[model samples]
Structure formats: C-alpha cells, structure tokens
Target: MATIQANDYLIKVDEPWTEFSKFVQSHHYSKIVILVDENTRKYCYNRVKGQLPFDHQIIEIKSGEDQKSISTCEFVWSQLLNNDCDRKSLVINMGGGVIGDLGGFCAASYMRGIDFIQIPTTLLSQVDASVGGKLGVDLKHFKNMVGVFKNPKMVWIQTEFLDSLPANELRSGYAEVVKHCLIADKKQWEEISKYDDLSQINQWTNIVVDSIKIKNKIVGADPFESGLRKILNFGHTLGHALESQLLETENRLLHGEAVAQGMILESMHSVNHGKLSQIEFEEIKSYIELIFGKLEKQRLDINDLIYISKKDKKNFAGAIKISTIDKIGSCIYDFNISPDEIKSLFSQSNFN
Candidate 1:
C-alpha cells in the first residue's frame, strides 16, 4: 500500500484492482459492500468487481447532487438492513464525492460506526473530497449540513478512472488543486497554472501528490477545525452558499466552479480592504477564469444570499468569519466583515 501521512491519519493509496483484496486479507472484515452510483456502475464497477478476491454485494445509488440527502441515506440504510450488513461488514465507497460522503455516513451510522474504504474515481474525489474524512449529506438545501469527520480505513485512488470523467468534472476538480496551491505552495500553484492538460497521467500523479501534501499539512494542524482548518474554507463560505442556492435551479453550477467564483469575489474583498494588492487580486481572478471560465450570474434574490450566509458553519457567536488572501500562497481567517460589505463584494464581482 502506497501511503501518505496526515495528522493522526494515514491515507493508503492502492491500485483499484488490488485494493479490496488487500483490505480483506489485512482486516477481519465480515463482508464487503461496495457503494457505487449509476455512473460508477457503468464506468468502473466491472473493473473493480473483477478484482475483488471474494464475492461482495453492491449498493448502487442514482447519480446527481439531488441524491445527496437524508432520504437517500435512508434508502441506503434500508439496503444495508435487507442485506444483513453489520458493524463488522466493510463499506467501500467506490465513486466520487457524493458516494464517498453518503456511503461514509451510512457506514459511520451503521451499528455506531464500521470501517469503510474510499475508492475515489474522479479527480475531485481522488485529490480533495475523499481525503479529509468529512462525511455528510445535505439538509434543507444546505451542503454538508449533517456530517462527521470519520476517517476511512483506506483511500484507493485510481488515476486511470479519471479518463471516464466528463471534461467539466475534470475542470471542477481543478479548483481544489488551485485552492491548495493558493493557500500554501507557491511552487505548486505555478506548476498547476503552467500545466494545461490534465489527461496526462504523469502530470496528474504529480498534481495529486502535491495537492494531498498541502491539504494533509493543514488538516494535521487543525483536525477539529478549531483554528487553522478554517483557512481551508477561504473560498467556500460564499462559494458553498452560492452553490447551494444555484443547485436548486435548472442552471446548476459544479462545486469547483462555485468555489472558483468564490475565490474571485473573496480576493476582491481582500483587495477592497487593502489586505491584498490590486495586481495580485486581479492575477488570481484572471488565472481562475482562464481555467474554469467566467462565472455566470444567476437570478438569485439578495435575501436568499443573506439566508444562506447565515447557514454557514463558520459563524461563531453570531458573527460570520471569512478566510481571505493577502497574496497567493498566504491566507487569513477570522476576518469579520458586515453582511452589507459582503453584498457589495457580490455586486461588484461581475461574475457574468
């Protein structure tokens, strides 16, 4: 098992085919249940299933953000019940973020927590979502509203699976890579910006290693998210709110796209406050736009923005804290800005 160490955690990166067998041989798991989505079942299930050393049951959920809810969890729990899944049975989350999050939740709640392995298929899952151990489902239009930080037994990243991902999904995962670079590594940021195509396996491997290292460093320092971990939400506050709102509409924005726009506006906020130079701010915006394209404005009510902002997890003692950039590779947190100031930044963002 190839290993990457995080604070109090070790991510075991294994070849997809050998991952299940390795887990079964090493651990005394009673049974294995592989959780997949429609997309993964079509593109990845056979390859994964063929490699398992033992006969394992499969649980497939429909593909889409709408499936990321408590109702879906109920369905999965029912499946587990019908299949006689117990605490000793292992759950292998074999898809992207949605499957990983929902499956992890199911496993965590089943018999008060069971071991689960993350077999992340998409680039986004491989690099960011699967590593942090933040598992949850959305509630009342909020993203990751109900969750827990339960680490997976192992995380198997198959770079080869990325070949089946849609181009937009590839672009979506790039945002987190960009976020990692912006928050910590200048060299990494430069390398990612310079490399255009993600289809190259060698390039992707390097990117994944660097991104995981950056995230692991931050998560190690603040596993409980009491301090430094808050910095990781730099673009996510407005980004996630915007994403939550937009997800309800017909014109949906991917998570990375929303975060890309969030980074732009947050950087703009930084510039307005004189915390970041105008040149630095503009460069950040330009680079994101170049890769993810410009953010298209949706007809969202100002009140909705307020409502969603209030739902942000970072609000402490009734004050919303934001993470902003003073420059690339550097971040600041706990900056209390007024709601009106946030609105003003949103208006001036020119997201269209």
Candidate 2:
C-alpha cells in the first residue's frame, strides 16, 4: 500500500480490501451512500460489498459522457435529499472519471459540503481523475466547463477492479498513463513505449504509482491551478475539445483516447515552435498512433475544432494558451496559438 498526502486529504493506492473495510467500519458517519453507475453497480460493487457492515443507499446513474450533465446532478441531489441525508452523511464514489467527477460535485454541493471518499475503479481514474480534487460535469460541448475544487475525505485505489475491463477500455486508460510519462517522466515514457501487450496488472502497478506521485506533488504546490499546475493541462486543451465535439456523434472518443491524440498534436506544436526536434516529434506521434490508432477517417472540421478550442479553460483574456512539451517528461505552458496554427496541425497528413 502507498499513501500520498494531497491537499487536506489522504490518497491510499493499492491498499488491501480488509484495510478499506476496517476504515468504513471504524468511521462514525451519520449515514452512507454510494454513487455508482450501471457498470459499477454490476461489476464493481460486489468487489467492495463484503467489507460494508452498515446499511447504505446506492445511487446509480447512467454510464457515459452523455449522462454527465446538470440534469444528472439534479437527480443525484434529489436522491440525497429524498433519503434524508444530512450534513454528516458520507458519500462513497466508486467508478471511473464520470462517477468521481459528478458524485464529488454532488457531495460538495449537498448541505454546503459533506465528506466523500473516492474509490476509483478504472485504470484511468486510478492514476489521474481520482488523485486531484477536480470535480464537475460537462457543459454542453465544453468539457469540464462547469466545476469546483473540492478534495475528497480519502481516495482508495485497488487494481483488482481492472480484471473485468474491456480491451478497448484498457487501451483508453493507457492514454492517461502515456500522458503522465510525457509530461513528467521521460524514463517511464521510454520504458512503456516498447510494450507490445498490457495484459498483466503487475506490470502496470508501479507505473500507476509513479503517475499518482507526479500529480500529488504538482497539486500540493498549486491546488487551485494558478501557476505550475497548468502544466498538468498538457494535452487537455485539444483533447477536451475533441471529447466534447464527439460526445453526441457516432464516433465518440473516450477521455484518454482524445488525450492521446491531443498529446500527439501538442507534441507537433512543440516541433513547430522549435522547442522539440522533428525526429523526437515523429517518434511520439508514431508510438501514439500504434497504440491508440489514427483518427484520419473522422475528417474533422478545422473551423469547428477551432471554435471549441477557443472555449478551452486554459484561454487567457480570450487568447488561446496551450501547454506543450519541450522534451519528454518536461512541459512548457501558457503559449498563445492562432486558428491557422490549429488548422495547420489538423491538415497535416502525418498522423494518418
């Protein structure tokens, strides 16, 4: 078991189920509620049920990006109210990014704030989403356009939950792992790039630990995302735009999938700005394509992508500011970009 102190809360990664059960039994919460989706309700809850000796309500929401909205938050809030939850009630968020984001928001808003614990199940959440205190839902086509900063009481991560993950979902989660490597650890990037298979959990545990440590250290320094923390937005500017644009379409991209593409595009931006070498840029792009595949068939509109990117949270005073890597594991932030630059990147035939 590894523990990292983030903000005012403690994050416990890969801890034993017995330790978690004991934690739940010892805490004197007035009431307990678990927020889960259809996927977690079926495949994840049983993995933790044996440890809970107290009666707790389960709030099940739909399991996708489409379901993450103000309406969903209303439903979750109403459930808590209907159940007579008070200021001291504890909420356990058990699922992936969607669950942790929306559920943490609900717990934060309920009674002006209450205690919530994060139990992130998927590989993506185990490393990224559950570590930081970013909680929110998407606003229309803008990703994370509405949110608040509220840390959970504690975060519990267990790798056993990964056993039932679908192959595509597994690959999707790897994108965040790759993002961590690119932004903070060059050696990890070199190590993970040669992997032909990700079928084993033990092979991934140390990587996950390293990723969480990177996030924890950054968040501890800049909790509200005012300065150095912006580096963490490395691939999110374009990645979030793509995720938002594709949400209602036939070819919806998972969070990590979009992020993988964003990393490639931003790495190319580094090349254009003379910060990264062309050879290193191609190597990054090629490795990403080999793992996450190419999006050439999508034929995305440059104008539409530009419009969405203009609305990215990273923009300052209506100017688009993006984060790019100067080298593997090292990032430079707050550079202005134009629509033509965005168009130029999208029009390139290289990614295909």
Candidate 3:
C-alpha cells in the first residue's frame, strides 16, 4: 500500500476497498453522500458496494464536462438540503476529474465546509485531480474560474476501476502520467516512453504511485500554491484554454488530450526561448502525438484562444504566465510569455 501524508490528509493508493469500509465505520458522520455520474454508477458503484460501512445516499450527476458548472453545483446543493445533510455529513467523490472537482466544490461550499473523501476512478483523477485540493467548475470559456483549495480527509485510489475504461479514456489518463514524468522524473520518462502499448492495468500501478509521490512532494511543500506547487501547472495553461474553448463546441477535447497538446505547443516555446533543444522538443512532441493522436483539424481563431488563455487562473498583472521545462524532469513555473509567442506556437500546429 502506498500512503501519502499531507498536512492532515492521507492518500492511500492501491489499497483494498475494505480499508474504505473500515475508515467509514470508524467515523461517526451524520450521513454519507457518494457523488457519482451515470458512468460511475454503471461501472464503479458495484465494485465498492460490499465494502461500504454505512447506508449512503448516491448523488448521480450526468457524466461529462458539460455537467461541470454552477448549475450542477446548485443541483448537488439542493440534494443535500433536501436530504437534511448537516455539516457532519461526508461527501465521497467517486468518479473521474469532473465528479471529483464538482463534488468537492459542492462539499466545500455547503454549510461553509464539510468533510469529503476522493475515490478517484479514472487514471487522470487517480493521479492528478484527486490529489490536488484545487476544486472548481468552469466559467464560460474559462477553466476552473471559480474554485477553492480544500483538502479531502482521505483519497482512496484503486487501479481495478481502470478495467472498465474505454481505450480512448484510458489513453487520455496516460497523458497525465506522461506530464508527471516530464516535469519531475527523467528516469520515469525514459522508462515509459520506450513502450507503445500501455493497455495493461497491472503495469500502471507503480507508475501511478510514482506520479502521486512527485505531486505530493510538490503539493506538500506549497499547499497554498504560493510558490513551488505552481510547477504542477506545467502543461495546464494552454491545456485548460483548449479544453474550455472546445467544451461547448461539437468537437470537444478531453482534459488529458488537451494537456498532451499543450505540452507540445509549450515545448515549442521552450525551444524558441533556448531553454529546450529542438531535438528534445521534437522527441517529446513525437512520443506524445504517437500515443495520443493529434487533435482534429479544427479552424480556431487565434484571438479566441488568447482570450481564453488570459482567463487562466495563473495569469497575473494582465500577463499570461505558464510553467515550462528546461529539460525533461526539470520545470520552472510562472514564466510569462507573449500572446504573439503563443500564437506563433499554435501556428506550428494544424489548429486555426
């Protein structure tokens, strides 16, 4: 079992579901709320059914990024209010990033605050979303425009849930794994890049463990995001913009897919700025595109992307700041770049 000790939060990785039951039994929560979407209810709820210690209420939202909004938060709040949920109630987020983010936001805003647990089902959530205390929903074309930092009491991750994920969904999560290696671990990058078929669930358990360790170390040092923790936003600047801009469009991009693309575009900036070599840039871009195929050729407006990117939470003083890597496994955060530079990078790709 891998355990991450945060300030007061604990992340248990690859642990048996029974541990969750015991933990629930140990607590005297007035009520329990398991937040899921239709997808999770169909593929995940049953896996943990036998291990739940309490009679919990299930709040199922529609499964997709479309449901991640204030309206969804309102619906969740209404559910809690209708059920007479008090501050003592525990909210268990039991799905991928959307569920975890929306559910956690709901829990944090309800009655000022309440305890919550993260049982991240998807690889993306298991390694990235669930660990970070950042919880929010998107606002218009902006990603995570409204959110807060509040740690869950515990985070339980089990790889068994991955067995039900579709191939595309599975690959989407792998992109986040690659991000972890690019920013924090060179050895991991070397190991993961050599293989093309990462479909095996057993093969990913350790990789997830290592990813969490890197994230937790960064988070632990800068829990409030005052400094070092921002490095975790490595590819997220453009990734969030791309994800949010395409969110309402017919051709939407998954979070990891957009991030994979973001890494490529940002690597170009790194090369142009002389921080990353053309060879390394091309190598990184090649591997990412090979694993996660290129995004569809969609005509995009450069100004639209710039506007959406300006909405990134990391931006300060009306300037766009992003985290970039000098080389594999070393990252620098909050580096400011020009919109012209971003446009130049986006121009390199087929978008627009």
Candidate 3 lDDT, tens digit per residue, 1-352?
Answer: 7887866788898888777888987888898999988889889997777678688999989998778899999999999998789999999999999999999999999999999999999998988886769899988745588999899999998888898988778888888899889998999999889877766345667888888888888888887889898888888898877887787787778888888888888878888889988888888988998887777645466788899888788899999999989999999888888999888888777643
Per-candidate TM vs. native?
Answer: 0.91, 0.92, 0.90
For all candidates in order, the CA lDDT equals 0.82, 0.84, 0.86
Backbone clash pairs for candidate 2 read none
Best by TM-score: 2
Q: Per-residue alpha-carbon lDDT of model 2 for 1-352, expressed as tens digits?
A: 6887777887887777787767876878888999999889888997678777788999999998767798999999999999899998999999998999999998999899999999988888888887678899999865577889888989998777888777788888888888888888899889888875776345566777888888888777888778888988888888877877787788888878998898888888888889988988888888888888888635576688899999887898999989889988898899778888988987764654
* Candidate 1 pairs with clashing backbones: none
Cα lDDT, model 3, residue 74? 97
Specify the highest-lDDT model's number: 3
The predicted structure with the larger TM-score, 2 or 3, is 2
What value does the lDDT take at residue 315 in candidate 3?
Answer: 93
Tell me how many clashing residue pairs each candidate has. Answer: 0, 0, 0
TM-score, candidate 2, is 0.92
